[model samples]
Target: MNQGQAAAVFEGVYARRLDMIHRFPPGLRALGTRYIEPLFVAIGPYHRHLPRVQEMERMKRVAVHQFMQDTGLDWDALLAAAGVVAAQARALYDIPPAQNQGGDDPAAVQVPEAADQGEPQPHEQGAGQQEQNQDGVGPAAEQALGAGVQEVLAAGHHGIPLPPLPMSNAGFQEMLCIDAFFLLHYISMRDADNVPPSALAHLFYSRRSLIDNDIMLLENQIPFFVLTHLNELHPIFLRPFVAKLATNFHGHKSTRRIPPFQHHGYTPPHLLALLRFCMKEPVPAPPAPDAAGGPQQAPDAGGGPQQAPDVEDGAQAPAPDAGGGAPPALDAAGGPQQAPDVSITFTAIGLEEIGINLNVSDRNRFTDMAIRKRSFGPHLFKDPLLLGRELVLPQLFLGNVSSNYLVNMAAWEVCTAESYVERDTIVCSYIRILAMLMHREDDVHQLRAVHLMEGELTDRETLDLITSLGKHLPMGERYVRMLASIEEYKLVTWFWIAVHKLFYLYFKKIATFFAAIGSLAGVFKAFELVLVKKHQ
Candidate 1:
């Protein structure tokens, strides 16, 4: 590597606190690039040269013109404003020297650095107008900001020498400015009632999924700071846009579950980061089980042979005193709650085969998941009905579009693994958990039966997708913790699982035979009625 090039590589790997935007690592890319690489459009330099995505350049220009018209800013106003933040934006992306397309060219990019990366205005200004530009250029900002058409990149410890952008400095600024426009216009037009007058908005309908997929790709992001900066210049309340997103993906519950995007309270490095935050928002624990049909108590809890609290993974639960402490406790309805004798490795069907049934979670986010105990029927009959413990999973739509978002988000998690603590790999962890549960087509069927999984993807396709995604993810804390939780649960409840297994494997067939006899009797009765009518 040239001295400058090597330095740039150093900056990406070692210089910054965490370089947030990145090219998804090729190691993981081996898993699949269908969604990793842009399929329809390119937002940043990473995939701008793809021939298929090249066609979308005109659309971006169209977005630029529309942005100019909507903001009522002259080209020079837009250029200068966008130019100021360019350098810092550039730093977040690690363009290895070989791919430093903008190598040695001076151009810059950056965005708001504070809450949602903005300071609250004591008073409101005109739409899109900012009283102060927190994004105003600095020594760091100048490092990446190109000198438009006039100035060549001056030699100094200016930020990483600009990649010789396919767009010279001026062209680079134009790309950033217009890319912001594309994202902004897309959001504003996401509303159903907006009824886009032009074909541009109409095009979104036909290509909506592809568009969503493209913008959200880990490699295909524009800095969120740029979005914030542009919003400062041209104000658009994104409430409606986010609301539609909530309604589309989640149910009509609206923004109740979705955290709103604001300028002051939250800041994202880019769109993917924002989405990661949204999807990983912690799901509240289900209300504590009431004593009536509530969960059987554990050794750690007040009551029975249940999972020990905070037990280390793979730890063995001590055997109940052979001397016979009081027998297992009774439920509210006086049903004997069976203590598990032993536990088994689980699949989705295995859980059902034993007793824990899958159920749909209340929220729409994939990360909004939990293992809950809810009373599905009479306490006396809970085991027969599969009513006690439930694995609550959110509905994954699992179409090309959702798949696109998932793979890309997981890709982001994998690529940015070191930048995050183990708990932060929510998406990757969630996907892996699903793969663990779903061992085959029957497992996918179980998810479908409860609406835990949905969309156009077939059962096989769904299993394939989850399997592929889960295979490549490094085990994150969330995944490990979940496994521990399940293991601990099994260690404590083995007796209960044994009882259920016996009844299900043997007694249930007898029960089915009796049920069949009852059905046969009903059929005979109906046939008698028909004979009488014919005689009459």
Candidate 2:
């Protein structure tokens, strides 16, 4: 270990791309490990040793046999190509926090379930990884929960090799091949009209819900590069598989066709990321101000019950100036990166009271939210409004099946946010937006009534999940801007709102007075009837 070697390590670690998959940060584990940990199966090296998922390990071998049999691809050729990819990807996983230092130091942060199960919970470096660490394409320096490799790199030290990987290269390559084939087979058979052949029928049918949940966990992911490399070597099944995952587990009976996200040039980091990319449409540019000096209230050209302005799926728009206080920002991996809370000032009922109606977008995307000032023209709600604004948003389904996935997607944004990233921290922002507009069970009821949300979850559960999830997330740019716009809308339209509130209160009081009179009349009639009976 010399100065030159140390500097080279620093450069390699510093210049590398961030980890493709990571343990959900410690702050988020309080939400429950079930939200982030895989419940059914492990897809990569991180969770392979867990006793709970070990049953599925045998299933992977079955997958290899089935995949080779079904596709008629040569096993030796697939192995050679995938093995090369495994070498390139060995450095992609995050080094466990306890990699270098054994967890004997009572202070190390332990992953709750992993620690108790005796699974390698990020403690003590394995010797194998260090020997494999030669200069170029070496394992990356990662930010483990408390112990950051970046910190040591920052301080400048003699070259010390990183801790060994969780598994050796030969073992890693085999794991990738098995895992990839397992997924390919799973996708090919999971939604077939006919019963899945053999063991797959039981594996995918009986545990369908749990397996779907596991697939979306951030920690339980393999690098997307492995899938792409395999795709290059003939069996190009990644496209429809990604589309199905993104479309919320739609039936993937045919993988040979359907080009939903394939043409978009999206290189997702993992399956969960692919889902996010599919759910996201780039934020649209703000409407330009008119000669009247307000955001132009353009008429709906596309006649619809609800429509988010059509834009190219790949169109990237910068965040509009919020026009208020400093909005919170998410930072890259490592260090303190939480933004201050920006609460939505209005609830669903409150918005309705102020004449701001919520509408669902035709395309269900997390990034879809728009505020259009009411103008005298043709509209999606069918009637042109002379006053009030239409707040358009995408429909969201909240239930046990989607809850964990939604939370992890938000956590992913927080964990992987980079300095030079886009303004949309979508899932978190969307959750916060929901939280901002919902205050109680009645608010959730309002959402359902308007078709903004639909799921098996009770109103209380939906309320609890989004509100709690919102508190944990760093406020996203999209959420911040929307909050600001609504706040500004309130300020400019205060006169109209005050007038509406006054009339609403007056009408409500009048209705209450009439209801009281009707009650008194009923009581008098009952007394008269009792007197007549006594006289008889």
Error of 1 at 354 (Å): 2.9
Instruction: For residues 434-490, write the lDDT of model 2, one tens digit per residue.
Output: 888888899999998988888878999999888888888877656666765676677
Query: Model 2: how far is 6 from its true place, Å?
Result: 9.8
After superposition, the stretches of candidate 1 with alpha carbons farther than 4 Å from their true spots are: 1-19, 96-168, 193-196, 239-243, 246-264, 282-345, 376-380, 384-388, 419-422, 512-536
> For each predicted model, how many residue pairs clash, with residues at least 3 apart or on different chains?
37, 6
Top model number, lDDT? 2
Candidate 2 achieves a global lDDT of: 0.60
Q: Spell out the clash pairs found in candidate 2.
A: 98-122, 98-123, 98-124, 99-124, 99-125, 129-164
How good is model 1 by TM-score?
0.67
RMSD of each: 15.2, 13.8
Candidate 2 Cα misplacement greater than 4 A, ranges: 1-19, 73-75, 95-165, 191-196, 249-259, 282-315, 319-343, 375-385, 419-423, 510-536
Query: Model 1, range 1-536, lDDT digits (tens) per residue?
Result: 89999889866675443346766755566556676667888787665544466557656666556656666665568768888987777666654322234542222222211122122111122343222222222232234443521132222123222233233444466568767777877876765545468777788778887887788888888877787677767655443243234333442343222323222233456777666655654333333444643223221111112322442212223223111232234567643343343232468877765666777777676555566555645433747544346667777777776677777778777765552233346688678878888878988887877787777789999998888778888765445544544555566678887877777677878799899999999999999999999999
